[model samples]
Target: MSGGYDLNLFASPPDCNFLCSVCHGVLKRPVRLPCSHIFCKKCILRWLARQKTCPCCRKEVKRKKMVHVNKLRRTIGRLEVKCKNAEAGCSVTCPLAHRRGHQDSCPFELMACPHEGCTARVLRGALAEHRQHCPHGAQERCPLGCGATLGPVERARHNCYRELREAWSWRQERSRTLVLGLLRRMREVHRTANLVRRQLAQLGGFLEEEDAMLVGAPQGEAEATPEGSMGAEM
Candidate 1:
């Protein structure tokens, strides 16, 4: 039981001298067994089912011989007690008899979301339907680049810094690849320019050597022509 209600805690002692032997709490719906030992209505019924003897003195008891202790019930009803969820932060101190009822609806109770990663604390009644549309518990992937794909409930555990680091890593990798490609192209262009310069130098040297050989051949042709004309005239 939630909503600031801790049903496990023993009920406070009532004003009447009567207390249920089984639960040790103030009598609720007190009933008198045939042995004359008074017990809570639920306690006696449960005991009678297992054994037809009163728990107080082991005397024989019958299912039909039980009687209601109306006076004790009224007295217990007036007893005041702390709220069931007092340890859980509920500060209401109400009648002991009304404790169960009051705690079921107490507003100060701390109720957690059943969603896996969500730590949201809400009122008791709001828990059941709160997960139906809880954004954190929705099924989705982390867009922040952590590569986390999970349900909304588990998504609460995602780390923001890790996601940011992953984004930076991707950007760096892409930039590095682009830079390497540009450097490779530049190297290839430099190599091509060097090859072109070397070819131009080799071509210019070959043309200069051909011009020297042609100029020497033209002088030899001029001397041979003069000798042939002088011999014909003789």
Candidate 2:
């Protein structure tokens, strides 16, 4: 290969297969501990910070005697020029010494919460903690009546108030409509009574005029009229 070591250097070596268990990254600056297990110095340091054990055999390696093996560092240095996240958009090639920093801020790194209405970003190391708290992030409203924004903890309270307000508003509107309908019906009844009174007044005026005409008529002629005959019979 164009790089220093054969691309297949660690390809199932017959006697000893060498690979960094943590990243599977080519091990550079290799260090062999008293336990006869080897790991890249940087990888071992990070691994030991999290856990104190050999990556390959799970043997306990003390923090003190991790000797520097110079040959492994040179091999890893040459292999570092390949993209760590080739599937992502990272085209930069550098030594393995810089791979950790590059991967830390890789743009293609998967980070955000997958939950709806949550916008929290999670790093690979902190995904578990992020998922636990992300559900409590701000949630969107239902948008039908009173639009209220609330966090997960307060959603129940917001929904309760919203429904109550809608119910109260509906009752108030119905009451107003009922009152107005009753007033309209009452006005119609009053109008009909006024019309009946006017008609009765007209009928009374006609009766008085007839009485006056009967009194003015000749006495014998008035006595022979049907109304005067009826009055005499009564």
TM-score leader: 1
TM-score of each: 0.42, 0.28
lDDT of 2 by residue, 1-234 (tens): 121233343223312334555555455566788887776677788788887778777888787988987776655554544444555555666665576676777655568775566777755556756755775445755444466565666654566556777999999999999999999999999999999999999999999999998878887685679887789999
Q: After aligning candidate 2 to the native by TM-score, how far in Å is the CA of 106 from where it should be?
A: 40
Error of 1 at 111 (Å): 3.8
The window of 10 residues in a row where model 1 has the poorest summed lDDT is 1-10
Clashes of 1: 4
Every model: Cα RMSD to truth:
15.3, 18.0
Poorest stretch of ten by lDDT in candidate 2: 1-10
